[model samples]
Target: MLQNPIGISRLVLASSSPRRRELVASLDLSLPVSVLSPDVDESVLPAWTPDETVRQLSAAKAQAALELLKGRSGAEGDELLALDAVIIAADTVVALDGEVLGKPLDEKDAAAMLMKLQGKRHEVYTGIAVLQSGNGQMHVESKKTIVTMKPFTEEKARKYAATGEPLDKAGAYGIQGLGATLVEEIEGCYFNVVGLPLSLLADMLEPYGIQAI
Candidate 1:
C-alpha cells in the first residue's frame, strides 16, 4: 500500500461530546473515525483567561489521547509513530463578564445559568487540538463567538431548562438544537458555537494533507 506522508491511517476524536462527534461527521470527510474519551482534569487554572483555559484543556485532551495511542501501538520508531491516526480534541466554554460557565449540574442550575444569560451577550469559546499520531505533530487553536440571547423571563428559562436539553451543555444551552430559539444574534463562527469549528478544522487539517471537502 502507498504510504501517506503524514502517516495518519485514520482520524480519532478524543472527546466524548456527542455534539462534537456529530459536527465532525457533518464535515463529510471520507476517512475512518474513532472516538476516544480522554481522562483529563478540566478544572480551570487560576488566573487563566477563558481562551487560555479552553486552549489548555483541549491540548491536554489531545496530548493524553496521543500518548495513549503511542502506548497502545508501542510504535516507538518515529516512522511507525508517524503512520498512526490523527487525534482531534476540543473543549468549549461559555463566558460572561469574564466568568466561565460550564455544564449545569441540574435543572435548577440550568435555569440559573439561562437566567443569567438572558438579555445579555456572552462569548462562546471553543478550543481545538489536532495532532498526527506516532510523531505527534499537532495544531491547536481557539475560536470565539459572541452570542446575544433574546430577553426572556426567568419563567421562560425555567421552562426551557425543564426540558433537560440545557443540563448537559455549557452555558446551559445548546445552540444547534432546541436552544436556537434563545439566541438573538451571533457575531462569529456559527459552527464554533455549535462546538467544532469546521473552517478551523479544515485549515488545521490542510497542512497535514487532509481534506474535509
Candidate 2:
C-alpha cells in the first residue's frame, strides 16, 4: 500500500486537469495523489439547473472512479482494497444568465463566448465530491463565484481566441492565465473561478478524516 507523508494511505484525484492537481497540492496535505480521469459523458441534461449540472457531473466522476477502484481491488491477487483511500472529483462551468458555458468547440466558438462575456458579470460554478473508498460514503457540494469582465472589442476577443488560450476553458478564459487582463473584478472565491474551491474542498473532506490544514 502506498503511504503519504502525513500517513494517509492513498488519495485518488478523478481528473486529468493539471490545474486541479496543482490546487490540491497547494493545500499542503503532504499526501501522494493518484490521478485518474474517469470516462464519463459530460452532456448537460436539459432539465437540470446549471448548478445541478456541475454537481451531478462531479458526483458521477467520483462514482466512476470508485467503481474502477473496486474492480481493481482484488485483481492479480493484489490487495488494493486493503488500503484506506479516498477519491476526489470536481467539475466546473461558467454561467451567463441561465446558460452554461462549456469548453469551446472551436476558435470561432471561443471568440464568440469571449465577445458575449465582455463587460458582463458572469457566474463561475464548481462542484466537488469526496468519497471514502472504505464505505462509499461521499459528500458533494457546489460553489458559485461572480466575475466581471473588462469591456473588450470583438477584434480583441478574436485575437485572444486565435492564441488558443481559451479553447479548453469553460468560459473562454482563465483567470490565472493570459485571461487575467480581461477580468475587472471577482466577487467570490477566486479559487472557484480557477477550478477547485479550496475551502469547499476542505469542508467536503472533513467527513473522510482529511483536513486541509
Candidate 3:
C-alpha cells in the first residue's frame, strides 16, 4: 500500500455514478475508496434554482451515507468508525434559461431535451459536498460551466438519443462521450459537464488535509 501523506485513512464516495468514480480514481490519492450509494429524495421544490437544487441534493447524499455508516455494526463497521474517512458526494444538473433539466425519462424525453439544447447556450452546475467522518465537518459548493451546443437537425438529435448514451446523462448529453459531437464550445471547466469538477474538488479537499498536487 502507498503511504498517504494527507493523513486521511479512507475516502468514501456517496454516489454510484461511474463517471464520478473514475474521476476520483484519477486523482490517485492511494487511499481505498468505499462506495456507498445513498438513497434519498431527489425531487426539488418548484421554487428552487438549479444551484440550490444540486447543493441540497449533494449534502443530502453525504448525510445519508453518513447515516448508513453509523448504522453498520461488527468488525467492518468498527474499523470504519476508527478511521478518518472523508465522504464525497455530488449532484449535477443542466440549466437552460434558468430551467433545470435532469436525466431524461426515456428516449423521447432525451431527444426532446437535445432538441431544446441545440444551437443554444446552457449552464452545467455540479454541486459537491465533502464530509469528514472524524469531526462531522461538511463543506458544500457548486460550480457552473457554460456550454454551447451546435445547431443540429431534429433527426440528428433523435439519432443520437437512439444511441442510449444520453438516457442516463443530464440534459440528455454526455460531453465526454458521443455527445461531444453536439457541443460547439465550453467556456468553463469541461469536467464539470462530465460530472465532477476536479480543480474545484481538489480545492475543497485541501481543507481536509488532502491535496491533489
Candidate 4:
C-alpha cells in the first residue's frame, strides 16, 4: 500500500510506554500513529498463571484501542486505525516459580527483586496481540525467555535501584540498558526480555499483514 518500509498506512499503538513506541517506530513505518493510553486494570488474579496474565493484559490493550478508534473511523480525515486493522499491543512479565514480577512498586521493592534475582535464572514472558479491524479478528503470540543475572550484593542492588532504571521495567530490570550489566546470560528471544517480542509479533501479525525483511 504505502511506500513505508512497513507498508502500513496507519498504525495505532495502544500504549503509552516509550519503549513500545520506539520499537514500533524503529520499523521505519510511513504511516501516522496515535498512542492511546490504556487505562485498564492490570491486576493479576490469584489463580491465573504467568502466561495467562500476560495474554489477558495484551488483549485488553488491543481491545481498548479498537473500541477507542471506532468513533473516529467514520469521520472525514479522521482515520485513526489503519483500514487494514493494524493494531499492535503487548505485555511482558518476569516470572520465578510461577510468581509474576511486574514493575516494582518502589525502590524497596526494586531492591528486593534484584536481591532475589542475584546470580539466579528466571523466565521472561511477553504476550503480543495484533488485530485486523475489518472483521474484528486478531492474532496473538507469546514468547518465553530464560535470563540469568550475575551475582550482586545488597550495596550494588541499592545503588542500581537509585538510578531509577528498574522502576518501570518488568523483573525490576531492563535487558536493553544499564541493566544488561546485571544479566549474565539469556536463552531466548532477546526482544522478549525487552518487552515486545518482535519475532513473535511479526509472526502473529503476518496472517493479517506484517512480516520481517
lDDT of each: 0.86, 0.86, 0.90, 0.80
State, as a TM-score between 0 and 1, how close model 1 is to the true structure. Answer: 0.91
lDDT of 1 by residue, 6-77 (tens): 545678899888988988898888877878887898887779999998899999999999877766566555
Candidate 1 Cα deviation (angstroms), residue 203: 0.4
Q: Which residue pairs show collisions in model 1? A: 7-83, 81-134
Question: In model 2, what is the error at residue 38, expressed in angstroms?
Answer: 0.9
The 10 consecutive residues of candidate 1 with the worst lDDT sum are 1-10
Per-residue lDDT of candidate 4, residues 1-213 (tens digit): 222223446667888889988887876655667777767789889998888888989988888888777766765555535365578888999998788999999989999999989998999999887766545566667889999999989999988999999999998998898899999999989988988877676566555445555
In candidate 3, what are the lDDT values of residues 1-213, reduced to their tens digit?
112335677888999899999999999887888899879999999999999999999999999988877666243658555247899999999999999999999999999999999999999999999888656778899999999999999999999999999999999999989999999999999999999999999988877668788
Model 3: per-residue Cα lDDT at residue 4? 32
Off by over 4 Å in 1: 1-5, 74-82
Looking at model 2, which ten-residue stretch has the lowest summed lDDT? 1-10
lDDT of 2 by residue, 71-179 (tens): 7777745455425778999999999998999999998999999988999999999999877777677778999999999999999999889989898889899899999
lDDT of 1: 0.86
Candidate closer to the true structure by lDDT (higher is better), 2 or 4: 2
Q: Which candidate number would show the highest TM-score if scored against the true structure?
A: 3
Q: What is the C-alpha RMSD of each candidate to the true structure, in Å?
A: 3.8, 3.8, 3.7, 3.8
Candidates in order, TM-scores: namely 0.91, 0.92, 0.93, 0.89
